[model samples]
Target: MSQIAKTKLTQTQLDAHWMAYTGNRQFKQDPRLIASAEGHYYTDIDGRRIFDGLSGLWTCGLGHSVPSINEAVAKQIKTLDYSPAFQFGHEKSFLLAEKITEFMPAPLNRIFFTGSGSESVDTALKIARAYWRKKGKGTKTKFIGRAKGYHGAGVSGFSVGGIPANRTLYGQGLESYHLPHTQVPGTEFSKGMPEKGKERAEELLNLINMHDASNIAAVIVEPMSGSGGVIVPPVGYLQRLRQICDEHDILLIFDEVITGFGRMGAKTGAEAFGVTPDIITLAKQVTNGAIPMGAVAFKQEIYDTFMETGGADYMLEVPHGYTYSAHPIACAAGLASLEAITQQNLIDRVKEMSPIWEACVHQLKAASPLVTDIRNYGFASGMSIAHIDGEPAKRPFQIAMRMWEKGYYVRYGADTIQLAPPFTTEKSEMDSLINALGDTLKEQH
Candidate 1:
């Protein structure tokens, strides 16, 4: 056992820190703390082995404690601890930026770095608006986001995001509107992408009519919704959105923060869905969740617009960045992570293992009567749980807690249970994780 597993903790220590996106009171009543993780398993503080069901909140699809990433981080901190992000340049950051384009679709080669996924979303939104303003169309300030679309928690992302509970407490946000979600009625238990909801892409026209396209800067959606319950876009849905955006002269942004890297069987959700957007927001698996990093890949034209319009060569163009925009350590971690992904052909591994993952997770439909819908794509999946006592979130929380007690870690949010097994997960590990979840769901009611 590791030394961390042996150390005991006190209530005072736990009380001093407030967790995010967690039920703090309930957690304090019965705490579940992890001391270490390796590959596809986690070691709890008591040294109990727990299967990694959600891959560290869909961040570590390459699994935990990757050796190459760890080595790179250690070497980087010793060599170049920090660099001024504003007017400085680093070799690894430039190399890492170029490396990221290998996974991005064509024409989206320009990269801008950020500290986290929220910052990436905000950066993408700002770029979209600024791009229009640079072209002398400053009126193009509105953004269109879809219902149930989760951009991130930043004020800009939260304003455009469609999750009600996330925005309710925060007062008015940006001048943004939402398009209806495309979960279309009667598409329950669909495998991969459904066929009926392609028409829902047309709803963007209604929004365009309500708020003229001249006022709209961009339309953002996750090619495959992650926290919003692993929702998959229907066939031709993204293509239609692209067509509408092209016709109305609005930029399209794909928040691939959760679906990028090898999670979608392809390098990115855009490649998986066969549609290209003007900008793509990325995080999570970019550095395999080993280090904090995020990036936005903009089309060549967007990058050129700023350069062409700036009055002086020395003056700032976009004038937006974080102190850790491209931290040296994060760049090192990202370079190592991407190199490892290419060396191991992990993206293809995800593609090959997807069928097995789908079959295993969908079996939960038979394991519990409470399952109302099951949706999956590649390595990611989410199942909707029936509400109990008019509480939609309770059953999922209960099921996840039961799974945790049984030595598995899964993510529970809103009204669903989400699972994203490690990309390198073997068939047995997949079976074990899904079977444990199935058994846990059966005991929920």
Candidate 2:
């Protein structure tokens, strides 16, 4: 009943807290707990230094314990801890919303805030359907998501999301179809965007014909699939998708949760890939992982449609929002993080470091026969491992655990090992991280 201050966790205490996306039974038997993090490394409970390979789940490109973000959070909690979400407003929220628009592409100036990436996906879906209804085309309610696309875990997002394990047990979600994934055969180790899969984007035409574009609300995808193993869209792939959406009258949504905010070496994925969507969902790095926040940015037309058609100023334009939509503390964190990103020019930092990153990781192709494929774009990368016993995820799990013991932190998902080093990482740190990974793979059975 009292506060537990001990850094070490008892077996009973560990059992009380169930972890998400983890094998709980195995983890409690041999846990890897991080006690603190600074700069680009984490210190475990036993005080061993571990390199931060994945940038805190792809959320901390500026690295950990940033001074500006820390100070802003402390001052905000003292000044304005919380604020009412409805009808009322806070100055920080307005400021944060405006700052966010500066990074988004032009005409996508309207902003809506939420609490996490999942919520942002759901909010974008709702906005798409609402926009159709306001235009008197309520029949436009279907959605199209690509195979291997990862939106998030909410009902709307989960249903539209394409990962089988994430969707199988949940049953049906919103009426949605999936386009084929872009990992075209025979194009495994190509650098940047592979040129072979441009036709894959044309699969959207089949889905449009099968269900009629008149009934479709939108097509949503990650510009570069992060959780789906960093599968980069082929050259001209996104452009073709944008062109198709234009002709069909269907809205296009880019779930940039993983690729937004400097991960793609640009203001947003739309800028990196040069393919703008009608709606863009964002989160993770909005506050540099210091505070939880997400947002949806859309073209001004969507917002104007609701305002012009709504009955009166007293009526709600759109009857939806979370209680913590724009908490003052989160707004403060967001503003500080954006300011730090701008001042430090971290986006350019990613661009400068990406070439060295790509060359270092690609060397693993010859390190061992177990590595089957490597995909990368900007600072994000993933390497697929040869499946053992037809269990694709097993080898990656073993590889990651070995990486942990060797003092590096990387993400293992599906059958791949993913890496996204902090933008501040130097060339020497990059070499050490990649060399360690190569040695680990060669050591694996």
Candidate 3:
């Protein structure tokens, strides 16, 4: 463990600093505290530089310790740190929304802010259900997500999220349904998009057919499954899903919290897969992880549907939105982060680095203990390793632990080690990160 100086702490010491989505006991046993971060590395408490592999939970697309973003946030904090988003106006919020809409497709021009990816997902689900109700199809209330696709951890999101471990623990929520996930394990080690997705797309149609189109409100899916082992969609898959949703009057939602921004080379998963959805949920990279913010991008029709419903103009459209909705500081962070991406040409950077990224992913084909498969797209990837029964996901977890101990960090779970370097990650960092991963696998007995 890197030596960390004893720093000032409030009443919330090791006992109270409970983490989210982490192994609490294990983590407390050996805490990894980051004092600061810059570029593609994080400074330990004792000041050891550790390569950032997960991009700060897949946010920080511009990398950490961004000076411009820091400046913007600092300036905003002194100007207007807090504001009422319910019935108030803020210039920064409007500016951020305008910038966000500028990148969305026509008709998906409206934006609703939330506090996190979970909120964004739950907001999207609520919008879908409400859209149907506003259209006099109140019975169309059920939502469809795919197996292994993680939207977020909110109640409604977990209901639709296909990760059994994430959902099975939490009982019933939102009367949800799940479409078959699109992980073509047979296509492991495949390059770019997977080779077979149409069949999986059929699963959506089957669900609609069995459940009856009128009762199905929306279908939510991650265009390229990122959290659930980096499952890439197959050829003609998303388009087929589009066709099916259209045929069944099902609202389509792309949970792009992980794929949004320039993470996927293209500006969005919708653009990458050539599949447009009625709503797109975004988080993570929106403010470059500088602030906790999420957004639900919806079609003009969906917003108008809610608007035309029997409700007063001043009343809540859906009786939702956080106290921090359209928060001024978050807006400031968002505006600056978006500006950074645009000015630095980060999206284009992903495109330029994609070939090298793909090659590196496939190069792991010969990696030991025998890499079963490598699924990669743009700058994201996950490698599968054969497990020795009852120890599913253990090998990759070991690899990730070793990677961290040796000065790098990566995410491991569900039998695959996921690699999601920052969109702004330098080529040298990428090389070193991959080298560390390779070394970890090679050195493991």
Candidate 4:
């Protein structure tokens, strides 16, 4: 394909590719066409490389076009490109699953694979429901998700997800409730965890008491909400949720699609924060987004319940799976990506480099024209915008559009500009992000 003409892609040629979760009309008119990418930059059609600030949506931690990952996929294609995951097993897939367990919290080691974060989320929801039914508690079918949470756009995710715009059109969401999201006003512009937000976590207990815990099977939340704006949990919030879930006999599911794979500066957010959950739904960084894949890590007891509850050898264990459950090519990419993360020591890099990242993010604090608030932890930060009264999102969208034209890619929405650069991003690259953001903000109003 590289041998083909590297001609200019006119608006007509680009129009056909349906965009996702974007203002399609606005984007198509002013498209920032990327022709190639390497390391922390994406080369545009004119050969101008734009800095990648979101790590291709919180994946690509080892950086773009990592040779090791590309070579592994290339080799796998010729060796064993495809395979059936049902009743048939492949070495790479099983090996990848086993490898995943090594990073999971102890006793929460069983794995179920899927093709994306939404599938992982849906998978978790189904497993939570199934696990309860297997234990003869069939009535515990409902779930709880926190407000502003994003689990992706799939059916089950859309069902349990709490984002209003993502759910309003769907009409019937799951039979669920939400613990109020913890973005306290007083904590605006707070550094890592908000000081005043732990009390808000008590909302879960109130909901549990009001709804009667028996009817609820699980409570799922992002350890640090990403797309809804990188709101890190308050110091004791997750621990409180865990305590409440334990007392109520409810399962806790951490939607770690953004928090998993070293995003929060640890192998997993549960480890980063010292609070464990029954399951963690993961994707994105799993294969560095090179190949789409997702997974659900669950405790051993949940797997045992399914096995012990099932009839005999002839009976199916759990009636859940995907056609591309353990795809050979994806499994290949996952193995390579996992190796790259460990070998490059990116998780430790996140831990060591976070302070510098924080100082850089705070520089925008003085440039209040571009920032109303800032929230960060590990390698991630989100900057809220000072919006006009009737148009809360206008400033953010305008600034992001400006930044896009200025050779940078950053996420802005929900009234803030979000950043989760690759774990390997350099101090210089970090400075560039802040500089570009500062320039964009100066131009916003």
Each candidate structure's TM-score, on Cα atoms with residue i matched to residue i, is 0.98, 0.98, 0.96, 0.96
Preferred candidate (lDDT higher): 2 or 4:
2
Give lDDT for model 3.
0.85
Off by over 4 Å in 3: 1-12, 310-312
lDDT of 1 by residue, 1-445 (tens): 4332345666687778899888888887677888899999999888899999999989998899999999999999999999999987989999999999999998999999999999999999999989998999999999999889999989998898988878999999999999888898889999999987999899999999999999999999999989989999999999999999999999999999999988999999999999999999999999999989999999999999999988798899878999999999999999999999999999999999898888988898999889999999999999999998788899899999889889999999899999998889999988888888888877775
Ten-residue stretch with the least lDDT total in model 2: 1-10
Off by over 4 Å in 2: 1-7
RMSD of each: 2.1, 2.4, 1.9, 2.6
> Model 4, which residues run further than 4 Å from truth?
1-15
lDDT of each: 0.92, 0.92, 0.85, 0.88
CA lDDT, candidate 1, residue 329 = 97
lDDT for each residue of candidate 4 in 353-425, tens digit (9 for 90 to 100): 9999999999998765557789999999998887778888888888877787788888887688999899988
lDDT of 3 by residue, 1-445 (tens): 2222254443347668678888887766666678888988888776788888889888987889888889999999999999997778889988898899876766789999999999999899887887887889999999888899898888988888898889877788878888787765577677888777579888777777788999999889999888898988889988998998898888989999999888888888888888889999998899999999999999988888778874877877777889999888889889999999899898899989988888876767766755788888888988877785898877877888898888897888788889888887777787788877887788864
| Model 1 steric clash pairs | none
